[model samples]
Target: MAPKAWTTKEVEAALRGQCEGRHRVAPGLYLRIEAPKPGEGGRASWSFRYQINGRSRIMGLGAVGDVTLAAARRKAEEALLLVRGGADPLTLREQRAREAAAAALAARMPSFREAAQQHIESQQAGWRNEKHAAQWAATLETYAYPHFGDVPVDRIDTDHVRAALNPIWTTKPETASRVRGRIEAVLDSAKVRGWRSGENPARWKGHLALLLPKKAKVQAVEHHAALDWRDLPAFWGALAARGGAAALALRFAILTAARSGEVLGATWAEIDTVQRLWTIPAARMKAGREHRVPLSDAALAVLAEARAAGDGEGDARVFAGRGSGGGLSSMAITMMLRKMKRPGTKKPWTDAAGETVTAHGFRSTFRDWAGEATHHPREVIEQALAHGLKDKAEAAYARGDLLTKRATLMAEWATYCTRPAGAVLPMHKAAAQ
Candidate 1:
């Protein structure tokens, strides 16, 4: 005869009674009750006992409080069916549990934007400064985010990457290139965390390169617009006539032949009035190396003027913005140049090619003058501009910065900038002097 099944009332009695032993509820289901231990309450739960290959096995259904007698019977009946089918019910349950866990993990995978943000946070410590981090975030937000930022990183494909880059590829080739690289980096990071698989869709060399035109092919290399070296003297005269922090900053930048970022970010602490030097920290320089700039008399005068205006002191910005005590806006010098008239004419000062002169272009102007009109060595000129050597052999041996030689070059440049426009010097004559 088949074993008797449990009733609801009998199951409730088993939970409340003082009995402490296993009681059969069905052919394979049983209610287990344990005696109360030291401070713990008595325990009652359901277990399904079955036979497989003439061997007994047990599976936990649930607690009596959670699984009712009727539910326990149904679960046991299912396990018995599986046992008769030559399958181990416990093994199947464990497999189901593992599958559920994997599903849960897949659901928690990050979106493209989330992955990008995580990657940026993880890499911030190695970047040069906060501005680099900010730039990374800004580009992704403006370019990458709108296309597929909310999509799961694992689902991102080449189509999404192409969508983000195609619009800017030819028009803003440089920015598009950066955006593509950033997307590749974010996707690579996602893959590393096992959130995604497959090759990176944003990769350029063998992948996107096949789809899009090369950056150089689509866009001509554009050099910064620079004033002709011959026009610099008259331009300097006009600049000296103006009296403002922006004008002073521009004058100082031109004198030092420094990049606009370096000039605008300069603090009084970086300037040594006695040594006539401006030392830019490695963090601020583009090459990630410390650079020493030899300051000329003209550059020193600009600093003095800034000092008189209450901007020069320890750690204070040499060209401070109004009311913020921070460095002047990056566009301050450019805007100053924009408003200046060409000598006596109403037109703005522009390069010979008719492009508006940019603050960075002054470096090119300085380089041209040094190469064509002065006798300074190429290494000294490059050192003054804080440029990295391209020749590996020369760079390996060129350990010194050529500071003394750079000082002489800068002083000559300053004198040339301040001299009369008509006083043109022959190259040989200037070299002899």
Candidate 2:
């Protein structure tokens, strides 16, 4: 009825019993029948045959040694299903293959840049400084963003990351390394989340180690500016002219060797006027331990003035603003300096190193003065500054606030900071006795 289907029995006899030449009969009629090469190892393999729009179509199956004779027959029969459906099995397979390839490529996958944003979001809480968090994100955004930003996480390789970093790696090694590590961290996160799967092309120890030079080999870089010691008098005088809470806060930062945020965030509750002490909470301390600042008479004087200006309300901040509307931000003190460059102002404060000093640099001045001019113990000076104790015993058992000692040290420090007495006077005769 259907042109009498071809029989495998007759085909076998045709190839094996009839021709008796070198040609090997592969499965499917008029399919691929190749002369076995010596290196082919006498293994039989499957081949396919079908028809499409009255034309012969053929396809290759895997080695017959890998697939049995019965298996090859079954494959050929399945291939025929496509032929019966008015589709060329070979052409259909190719079209389907291309469609699958296109579908895979079109799949939505996270890029390296997106992975970095996710990583930052997941870990923002642990960072100490909010500015540090900004720096962390911004560095990647600026440097690595253009190179690897659009690259799919799975497609990222060692060279792509290295390419982004190599431009700055030699000259600005520290920053470059940080950028590299951040990229690695994001990729690692991707791997853990199953977004990517591969050997980490970014790992520093076993892989990138072989390519890039060690970062630690390079010398550390310095900041843009520093102050000279000889110019303190004029700078101190200029500071005196700003003359308000901002000026006071700057002076306090200098006087205590504390950071700007610490001084601005101060509240009245922290000060015990009767006891002449300021107990900074552990959360506020850079060292994450409580620090008691001993108040000098001058410091107490400043506090009293601040308190008088504040509402008699006990909870009032010694330095309050209208709730983030106009408090002393980090820019506040820096802006005050820039204003000093205004016409009719005398510029002061050049460092021994011959650069303009910054708001934070005053701490260095105070530390230098403490070392050169005062007799306070190094640990006591450090304790007064609320620097965490390096000494094990002091760190463990010295729980009691050493406010009295700090008060005395700060008073002595304040004496050095303020104008010297008009003239040194002799002690009275009774005091001499």
Candidate 3:
């Protein structure tokens, strides 16, 4: 027997009565009213009842306040048609809802490129230099961007990261490793901001490690190319003959055994001519600690030349560039080294391995000379080179910068560096012993 279709007045009357029961409106539709309970008002809503494949199901349309009688009838008719076609309307509705939710979530999440840029900006203040930020951006753009940069951060998976890393993983292991780490960092930042979730696809220790060969296994560790200490005196003489801010900067760097960035970024305020000290601030230092370099007469003379060429007062660049008041370019010394010729020969100065000499190689040269040719203690040499003590016990015990001992050691280094071409100094008997 077919139940009577409910009229608008019957539906309103049933809702007003607040009865706890379902009243049929049509063959597959009902108006449900629930009695008030414990400080809550009565409730009225619309529901559709139907059978598909001999299984009966109920689906809520909406509240009485939202679904009108006519609208409820239209919805029920649609559901009845779906039932007749052997499809469950409830399942289809839920599927559409899930798809809509995913689309909205994707809209809210940033692309990998945008997330990477934001992460880099947030971390820039802590980085030692602008070059570090530049390197991060460059590596990601060159490797990761083409593969998945425009993809939403939440959608970035292992496959996307693997595609970016696999090509250069074996060929350029160092760069590939940095790219992987950077991608991991960006994704981590995204997760922290709630823009993404799940495991980091670029993680190396346990995840990517399983997929790729270890970095060390793929390539041997490569040190900077350095001039042999034996060949330094002649090389020094030739470098001295050249006249430029870069040449002077290189000479100062070699004398102090400082890193290239440290040398290139030097300012007049960091130097003290009276005290013979070049104090590098913690912000500019790699170890993030202030280091005092006891300047040699040669280093000071180079400074004097630089001062004569430009303003030598507070905050001025020690090696002023041709561009207004700025420090010399970081590549200045490297380019100078590449162009420099060995004494009386057209050949460019190179390490024993025949690689071109690098500005940073001077630190290695100084360490070799201090260890193999001088009687200076290891810690003093390391301190002069601004290296942190590897031994925690030794480091904790060491309070002083060993200024007096290092001053003397640097003086001796200065003497060796200024020696005439073809002169050979004997190794320290103590070192030899």
Best by TM-score: 1
Question: Each candidate: how many clashes?
Answer: 0, 5, 0
Q: Candidate 2, after superposition: displacement of residue 99 in Å?
A: 27
lDDT of 3 by residue, 155-255 (tens): 99999999999999998998998999999999999999899888898998889999999998998576899989888898898888889888888999999
True lDDT of residue 171, candidate 3: 89
Error (Å) of candidate 1 at residue 397 is 2.5
TM-score of each: 0.71, 0.60, 0.70
lDDT values, one for every candidate: 0.89, 0.68, 0.89
- Predicted candidate 1 versus true structure: per-residue lDDT over 55-83, tens digit per residue: 88889999877888889999999998998
Tens digit of per-residue lDDT, candidate 2, span 1-433 = 2234345665455445333332323335232334556777233345676667778766876763466556666777778776777777787778999999756744768778877887898888887657667988999998888887898888998879888888887889889888888888888898987788988887899888888889877647655344443345456666766665667777766666676777787787788878877777876777777777777776777776666656523555565553432345667677676566422556544456655567877776777766666666666667766776787876797675555666666776676666542323222111110
The candidate, 1 or 2, that scores higher on TM-score is 1
Judged by whole-model lDDT over C-alpha atoms, candidate 3 comes out at: 0.89
All-Cα superposition RMSD per candidate: 15.1, 19.6, 18.4
* 2 or 3, greater by TM-score: 3
Q: What is candidate 3's CA lDDT for residue 119?
A: 94
The residue-level lDDT of candidate 2 at 316 comes to 57
* TM-score of candidate 2 on Cα atoms, chains taken together: 0.60
Clashing pairs in 1: none
